[model samples]
Target: MSDRPMTTTPPRPPAGGGLFGRGPFAGAGMLVEKSMSFWPSTRRLMRRLAPERARITVVLVLALIGVVLSVIGPRLLGWATDMIFDGVIGKQLPSGITKEQAVAAARAAGDDSFADMLSRMDVVPGRGVDFGALGTLVVWAVVLYVATSVFAWLQGYILNDVVQRTVYRLRSDVEDKLNRLPLRFFDGQPRGELLSRVTNDIDNVSQTLQQTMSQLLTSLLTVIGVLAMMFVISPLLALIALVTIPLSMVVTKQVAKRSQKLFVAQWTHTGTLNAHIEEAFTGHELVKVFGRRPEVEQAFQDRNEELFKASFGAQFISGIIMPTMTFIGNLNYVAIAVVGSIRVATGTMSLGDVQAFVQYSQQFTQPLTRVASMANLLQSGVASAERVFELLDAEEQEPDPADPVPPASRRGRVEFEHVSFRYEPEQPLIEDLSLVAEPGHTVAIVGPTGAGKTTLVNLILRFYELDSGRITLDGVDVTAMRREDLRSHIGMVLQDTWLFGGTIRENIAYGNPRATEEEILAAAQATFVDRFVRTLPDGYDTVIDEEGGNVSAGEKQLLTIARAFLSDPSLLILDEATSSVDTRTEVLVQHAMAALRSDRTSFVIAHRLSTIRDADLILVMDAGRIVEHGTHDELLAAQGAYHRLYAAQFSGALVTDDDEVSGEEEVAGVRG
Candidate 1:
């Protein structure tokens, strides 16, 4: 049987309608769109930067300086334009005439408009342009632009550093959170969903901050600086440009409201699809065995299609903001241009001022467009942030006691007193179950499926806390002792063998990291692992693949036994450790387990009755209750639950004086 706890079930997808009231798997309640607290999530994300406040302040100052310099450039160029225009007009007039005399002459000729325009010009009559002054203004503008670029670059560099550091800390917190969470928490969550939060979602958050932070800051600063410059040049044109501000806000608000939901849907579908793919690949063999390829492919296609729709909708909706803002800005630009020209012709404003206002108009609208564009990115980023925050905010397991009971010595006596546990509240699986294993004795537990055998062992390891009652180890309450201390004295070997991607020597030594080479070799030899290691090309140095497929099933079991042997644990758990191996291999495994179990309290959970015939005590459990318990011979003599189970295994062979030898022969036949 699979080692997964009988009470554990696969997580079901959340239920609701999609953003459009329809989507792939809508009937199954998949791809449901969740409303997000955008501002709250965004604010929380910003708070993560609190540690870098000083550096952020420096970045802000740099950006301000850059904006100030950039805003001054167009004004300086406008002054140069006025100088050139005035010089051309003044050179057409006679020499030795003052600018006031030239304007009076135009007034006397009844050209009031021309006279007013000349009054606005800074012309010296009959004097050519001051090339030196023009050169100075042009040079100043160039210097200001270069300085602006430098400051912008500097701030960008600093902000990038801040974002990277913040993300690093966030990743560390997430990893720590995963470690502190209880096993039950993981049991309910899909592996793919958790992985997405840790890897994909966090990565998206980093990219969003990296791409949007600098650009958003710069755009906002430009809007402020350029607006001020626009008013300074011509308040009339400035007012015209400001007309579009409300319209732009309305557009952004409408588009963002819809796009935010779509973005949330996009990422939600992304996680769901990832979960399906991970589940399918991890169980690829099972899928093929059951001929579920078409069903799996169809599910993948449905989720993939939903994701595409969500992504396209998000991008398409947010994409409308730029063009719409550009249209409104173009109208504002036309209004500014026509009004500024009239003001210039009427001498109310200079041509230079009109030119400056036009440049400011473009500068103003460009930033607004950029701000709108960044809205989509911000929405997606915050969506990911909310997911990560959800993970971090999950309820953690009860912390270890401040003052734990110290285990100065371990004798491996284990006792369960009135223990009660249930995976779900309303459905009780184990109630008031009690058992005791004396020191240096083998207690075998035999049960059918769903009989709570795995859960019992899990409780011993503190993998799950009891709903009631206490467990004691060596006369000390297990809860009072630190989990690390309690587990340190216990070693377990499961039906499903696991080995990391490392050498055989390293896998064996994992049981005791501080074990010396000689100790490791001795444990391997005792567990029959040395016999196989010598056959391999590299002996103990042979590298195991991630799946441990390079070694046979029997070999993997031997390695695990070797690991347990190296620990020399006072308490050992073997949950059907030899069930998966061949009969020939089972003999060797039984011998290895016998060597490991000597002088240690061992809890053996098995389905095969023959394996526990020699056990000091045997427990027969049914429906989470110990239906019968005693020595194997006593239970068989009493013709209780153990006898029934044993008889069922042998096809109802009755126990008798003549049948005793045949029973032994039957056991041997079953093993072979």
Candidate 2:
């Protein structure tokens, strides 16, 4: 492992200057720059989901046009408000409005004295400012409002398309990565935690891009345009409005910095809670059998409470940003009103200019508040991104060397030459030991529990790497063989059978996708699994629950046997294959194993000594070493470790070479 520990850094903005401005935008560009450095992966994802760059370009162009029109149209509305007042109340109507028109409009206005007051409010002594063309401005303002509405709708259309496609592609890429990850990558990590990466983390990114970014873009554009308009109308008032901008920004940054850690904690706890729930549900039988209901419930409640506290802290901190921003905005608004009043009273600024400045101040502050809040969502998004990237960055299992030397022909022979292994380096599970199984022979291994029987099988298949020594197949080093091709020729039926949530046919066919219905039925019959399948309501079509929960342990094991039979691999590893079944089911499993191993090398780790008495070889193992090995009768004749174990099981029973029965004693039952 690297010396660096896993930790999240604070989200920084773009590195280069922003397209429109500096500060946060420039920081945002820096972030984009960092993300772009992983362009090969990002580009692949983008191309897969979007497929068409032209569509993206079109959407962005339309969005830009919409933003421009929307900004310009709102200003036209303010312009028309001033123009309408000038025409109807200030007695400065254009040529079309007569004295009769003003009187009629005044009476029709009714309780709208505010309009008349607004008209009277604008004045500039000793300044020649004509208001005769105000009627034309009103018509133009109405047109601008309609245009702005149309552009806003167009922007929505473009943004929605881009966001949905981006989400679709991101999800697809995550699923693909999950499929390609090796089995060792899954060890110790809960399925629920992995599932959250595909579901919850991606949802966070989507929410940011859709709702947060949309609001962010609008607020940014409005602030820029409003500031420019204010600067044009009165730089003094614009400066006054801009004074509060930095304070609001500082508050927002503080809120984001304080709340980000809390949000990350909350999401992490959510994953832990999910893992706990899934484990409880999956192990419900074990919990009940062990009478651990209270223990399980308390464990769940502990994780739940942690999640709740973290969420509360995060949300409570985030909620404060909006109100705090509102308070600052109101204060700035009051300052602008007072300053504008002084300037207007001194005849330095017109009423129209003051109104525009106030509007601009509101525009500036509202987006500032929006940008602040969006910072919260963006922070959450970045936190999620960090987790997802970490998963993607995990080291993959080393692949087999390239250009592997192929065998002249695959013979059912396997040899372990001084193989030693450890699940963890501090404790070795398998010592430096060697063993071999000849072609078409059955080798039965009996060992005390934790004596590494299963670990031995796991090594042969290369499910794990041996720390020392080599495993060979057909006299060739298996490590030099391609993993896919190496495993393709080996069949495994683990003690615990796992069936996906699908139909019985699907479960059996999983071993070989191209297997026909006839082939599946034959294999099922051969394994005696068809007896139970036929009793089900849907027969072969019955759907199995995850882990084969819908079926009994015996039936599930039998189906797994049927799957292995269908595969018909040359080398078979049956790791406690019938340990979960009753004697009757065990008989059927033995029959299936016998038939399957007829012409193939087989390794059986059996608890029932009676099951493997006819094996060509038997190895008695204890504490990671082969204490005794020979043919069953030869070992009994030697009267060594195997002799003592057999004598203890069938005490005083006379034995003959012709007799097929052997003592039903395994290594763990009589440890020596």
Best by lDDT: 1
TM-score of 2: 0.80
Q: Compose the digit string of candidate 2's lDDT tens values, residues 1-672.
A: 011212222112223222222421121111101221222433443454356467656655655665566556546656655554444444443345544454446558773443344334442222223555565766676776677677667767777787788788767767766655655666635666666667787888677677764576677777877788888877887888888788987887788767777767766776666666666676677768877778677767777788799789878898788889989899999999998877765546655667767777887898888887666676666666655665666666667788886656667798888777766566555666788899989999985566677777878877777788999988888889887778888888888888999999999998899999899999999888898888999999999988776899888888887888888788888888887788987887777778778879999897667777889999887667777888888887676667665655555454344332343343323333
What candidate 1 gets wrong by more than 4 Å, as runs, is 1-33, 539-541, 650-672
- Global Cα RMSD, each model: 5.2, 11.5
| RMSD in Å for model 1 | 5.2
Candidate 1 contains a number of clashing pairs equal to: 0
Q: Mark the regions of model 2 whose C-alpha exceeds 4 Å error after superposition.
A: 1-59, 92-184, 344-348, 405-407, 643-672
**Cα lDDT over the full model 1:** 0.84
